[model samples]
Target: MSLARRHREYIQSLTAASAPAMDGGLAPAAAFDAAAGHAPSPAGTISTAAHTINLRLQHDLRRLKEIRSVANKIAVKQELIGEYDAWVAGLLEAGRTAPRGTLAPTGADEVLPTIMVWAIDTGDWRYALALAGHVLRHDVALPARYQRDAATLIVEEVAEAALRAQAANNAFPLDVLEQVEALVDGVDMHDEVRAKLLKAIGTELARGVDAADAGDARRLASAAIDRLTAAQTLHDRVGVKTQIKGLEKALAALPAPEPTDPNTTAAPPQT
Candidate 1:
């Protein structure tokens, strides 16, 4: 199904569900409407109706979680990255819409693992970066290990793509570079993949050193310095310096700052 269609159906199922009439006996029409919160009435048991809705929501979310592997493959084959994004987004919406009291941390909660697996297995960095950012931004707390592992996979996959492109002496695609840079900005790092990530980031930055757009030099230098600093922390600076030096030279060539008017002195330190 198209992601949008599937999503509409999912939403329909969620919003349209009503608690089974107590013990299979039908609830009074007015009571039922009131219980479902479709109307205000004094006779309905709102608490019972709410619990029923939460249970149904929990069930559907679990089902979605179960089907995630299938969804993952479908997403990749059809280039349905947006669907994957929507599915995760839907999970969040479900939490608020139906309101589960205590979600087990396993179902939609752990979908990032599968998404990260797809990214690494298919060597799809774009999808991987989206998953990384989604998890980092998510209001639901994923397990610490999943967070760590997702970061590792995101870096490794980006570096893998960057290195492959580098082998041909071609720049990494700008989109890929930007996504990886965003991941680096948000995800926590592990030393195991630190140098690899730095290499990719630094190489992309270094490309600006000789760019026709001379304006890119300082930007590249600033970017590289940031990564180089992180690499130093990881104790994984194997290939960082060369890129840093190259970027430093590019910054050196930037036109000297416009003469600051002695009249335009730096703003006094903010109070």
Candidate 2:
């Protein structure tokens, strides 16, 4: 059989095997209360709760790995895209059963985000997009500390992936960049963190452009700088002003650009 057909069969097999095992019952309410520190419990009970949480986390992770394997294979075959979407949907459903809130089983927070990114990386845009939306909704419902941290991490991962795509000269880098930018813009964040992240993205873009055409590099770099500057100005204008002044002084110390004379036929001066 062709590789695509084989991959589809493999995905089918994986899905059949990944149905959550029906053997285990939900932990007792007392277990959750102990885990969340609402009731004082002995170390032994807490350890038991931890072990249970770990087992559930492991099952979820295994399913994610299998789904990701299928997704990766499907990404290379246009005909198998639907298969990929189905697997992504299955994985997302498994992720949903994990605990949330103070009583959430340990490690659920970290694992959910990872599963989301696996979908994102494997070209399962619909699921990835849904995961992003789900996270935003969760952020609104949950306390700021958990919600903000999760949202920020997702934004960072998406933005970093976009930068990597740009560096590799991928045709789809612009789309990824725009998606990440939209996600970042949709959220509420502290000014300082936002400025730092935007500046980091700009630096990455500038570096990528260094090996590209001069005009293109300049345009990208200028755009990056503008994003950083804008972010900084919004909440920390004084700090940004000082930083720009310092940068200007440093730039002024550099030699001026050599004038190009097209009529003279002489080579422009090298840096």
Candidate 3:
């Protein structure tokens, strides 16, 4: 049977069971009279049953609201995933057409130069310099078939330029430093080319030390130390002993700046 018809039949059975009993050989009016004083009439009983069904219907409506809330959240999540998929497709397309090894160019070049002209633009300098460094490093990783020596030189030049720009603007140096370290680590250079890259790194480190601001000096020094350590580890792992010596020599040549004292008393109180 249909669900609604079955429900109606069930309700009819319950109503029949709850009906007031008749007296012996009684007419409908007599039955009503007999039950009137002690038992509810059919109309009152049916009204109570209807009220109960209404209460259950109201409860079902509340549950429906909760279900709808969960469904709305799922719909929103699906939309977000769709948007992300579209964005990834666009990025892959751009990467396909980009100059071999170069990533998408930034819109901030002119803005960065303008900000650099204004000495008070502290926030923009660090963000712009880091962004520029990221783009340049991507260029070094282009998939074009090139000789190892040429690629190594190109990476080293880009790294040095990025480091210099970061130093110039008193920018947070970590991003540029990490990029340079990656270039050094990933480049497959022969002995002569590796030595040249190491020399370039040494020059960059020296410039960083000489030009680093008071706030950034410690961070730059720490990053330089880490980069040198990483380069040594990479060399050992790759069995490239030729570059390891040059990297070691570069590490040794870096000046050890004196440690800053955190607590120094300059004033004496007289009684």
Candidate 4:
């Protein structure tokens, strides 16, 4: 299959992989609490309410541990991609069960963004994308800006992986590229981070221009133009601006595209 098509499939698989298990085993928190007939403790004096909160948190952690152990077992036997995907689905559902204002950072927050990347390295990009999405959702609930930052860092690593794969004639990291775009949607990355990512993409795209045929140069020019154009939008970092100028000049000098079909050569009109 074409790399592009596979990438598109990988992205679509995220939604399917995120689908909840059909066995009807555990209901969402709201439904589960209702069915179990467990009422959350009423708000009261600070100390008592705090105690209640801690107890509930402990229960929640225990449930997460149950799934984590099962997921690890699956990872040992099957693919971590499948294990992480199902685990994410369960975590999201469990989030729904917590009483309003009671949802806080769980230990899953640390692992969700981490394990998925391992899956990516092991050749499960789709599952990694799904896992990152789940982790980002959890980060949205936290007051720590750094969790979001960490997610972006993971995405940048994925972006680098994608570029490397492209160079090696392997899978495209478009899923991870999209993830990077999604991660930075409203967030401002540090200047260093922004410049580092842009430089990596630009340098990689520009690597072969000196030796490339017209077609290859044109392809490289197009990607560099797009990447540096986006870098401008990201920030006015000096390094990025330098890259943009150089790439634009090189693009302007690239020859027009070469025709692909041998039988369809350029021809003069007959009189």
Candidate 5:
């Protein structure tokens, strides 16, 4: 069978398997809590669904651990993207069962953040950013091994991906980079990482300066300079000095705007 067809079937199977856990067909979280000598969660908090999801998370994480190399992990991520989508969808559906404010953190959840990374790895920017909104809202802790907060991870990973794509002359979506910037605005992260993001945005903007008409070239180049300058100020080693010079030169070479004819009479207003 073709890979796409197989992938669809896999997603369907995963959704079918996860429906029971989402619907509370699995063992109650209270039973596991009591057995482990942990205090029970408050009533209607959906601990049963949380516990079921956690069990699935543990299973997936174990499988990930067995992959020995980066390439292998990437391949596995492609295979599992469908599964992650189902899990995320199930969580969103299950969350509706409880009041928004009443929903408590179930401690560190590796699933959502892991899925975020995997989504990025597989070039699923839309999916990754959607999850970023939820993860940041809840202040979900990333896995211990990540050693970075969600905002930092999101910025750095997406920035690095954009840079790589640019290097290869591939068209990385500027909107995706802009969305990442807006999503993580005001969140604390290393200056270096932030600079990387700015550089990516600046470079992407600079790409179109050459092909643009005089007006557009000036505007794009100016914006590119602003971003690149901010990046340089944040981290001198961000390595955008050459790009800045090139854009500035281009902007300077653009034809000057025609002088406004202030003496010309204004056209009559249309009905």
Candidate 6:
């Protein structure tokens, strides 16, 4: 279903408008009234609707924290991602309709970036990359609890996931890794994190060597070696030395290209 439509439905599922207001307590009816009363301004102001959404977001965040504290398994946390899907979709809808460059601070500012992380945890690469584009383009700030900036978080998180997938013999898309590299291009991050990215890319490239033709195998091996070597240079302990050596050996095993005859004359173009 469309996110915008889902958002409207989700909001309707909250407390009814006729509910009596509570003193210094959450008043869903008042929140709804405020949302209906105030339209978002063009000057990056947080609308009443966004404020109301933030209240719900805070409750979800608290629940998430409680779950995370007791949950030790990655699988358990991955399963919890679905619970936040509607809220994430709502944030995306709001952001899409906001004026250009109007991404101001809000109580729910952490929602989208946090969902991006969850997307990666669940192996939802397309969703993660889509959120990455929005976060980077709008310059969204991550919550204070996070130690890294958006670019660093994205690079490190995706790189780590790719490396883990490789270790487990799972199929991680090479184009997804390449797209990530392009997304964070020119953004400075830790050398080791960058090295990990290169390692993932090079390893994925090397995987095709067995099925490629002789010439293609040579080309792939060369490219892999270049990337792995650069990764090694960035971090001596990046764990790519063995991989680099393997690619180098593969490239050495390829037969040299046959040279053209120096004395051959060019044929005239066919009529």
The C-alpha TM-scores of every prediction are: 0.51, 0.39, 0.25, 0.45, 0.76, 0.73
For model 5, the superposed segments whose C-alpha errors exceed 4 Å read 1-49, 90-102, 106-108, 263-266, 269-271
What would the per-residue lDDT of candidate 2 be over residues 199-271, giving only the tens digit for each residue?
Answer: 4455455454446565555566556557657757765741345544444443444445567877887677999
Cand. 6 Cα-lDDT: 0.72
| 163-265: candidate 5 lDDT, tens digit per residue | 9999998878999999999988999889999999999999999999889999888899999999999999999999999999988888888999788988999
Lowest summed lDDT across 10 adjacent residues in model 6 is found at 15-24
lDDT of 3: 0.38
Q: Tell me the tens digit of each residue's lDDT in model 6 across 153-254.
A: 888889998998899987679999999999999888889989989999999899999899998898889888888998999999999988887788888888
Compute the lDDT of residue 243 as modeled in candidate 2.
40
**Candidate 4 or 2, higher lDDT:** 4
Q: Backbone clash tally for model 6?
A: 0
Off by over 4 Å in 1: 1-112, 119-126, 136-148, 174-188, 213-215, 253-255, 262-271
Candidate 3 residue-wise lDDT, 1-271, digit = tens:
4333332333223323322432231112212222223233343233232334345434533544465565563443333323222222322344344444433221111222222212112223343343334334444232222233334544444444444454475343444444444545655655444443343353355346545664455554444454444444534442224433554454455656677787977688886
- Judged by whole-model lDDT over C-alpha atoms, candidate 5 comes out at 0.73
Location of the lowest summed lDDT over 10 successive residues in candidate 3: 106-115
Report every candidate's CA lDDT: 0.54, 0.47, 0.38, 0.50, 0.73, 0.72
Candidate 6: the clashing residue pairs are none
Q: Compute the lDDT of residue 201 as modeled in candidate 4.
A: 62
Best by lDDT: 5
Clashing pairs in 5: none
- The stretch of ten residues in a row with the least summed lDDT in candidate 1 is 22-31
Candidate 1 lDDT over 1-271, as tens digits, reads 4443443334334334454532232222333333344553233333233334445445534554666586465454345333355545444454444543322222234444455555655656665665566554443353454454555666676777787788688777666766765656755666757667776776777666666354566666677777766765676545666666766776787875556677776778988
RMSD of 1: 10.6
Error of 4 at 229 (Å): 6.4
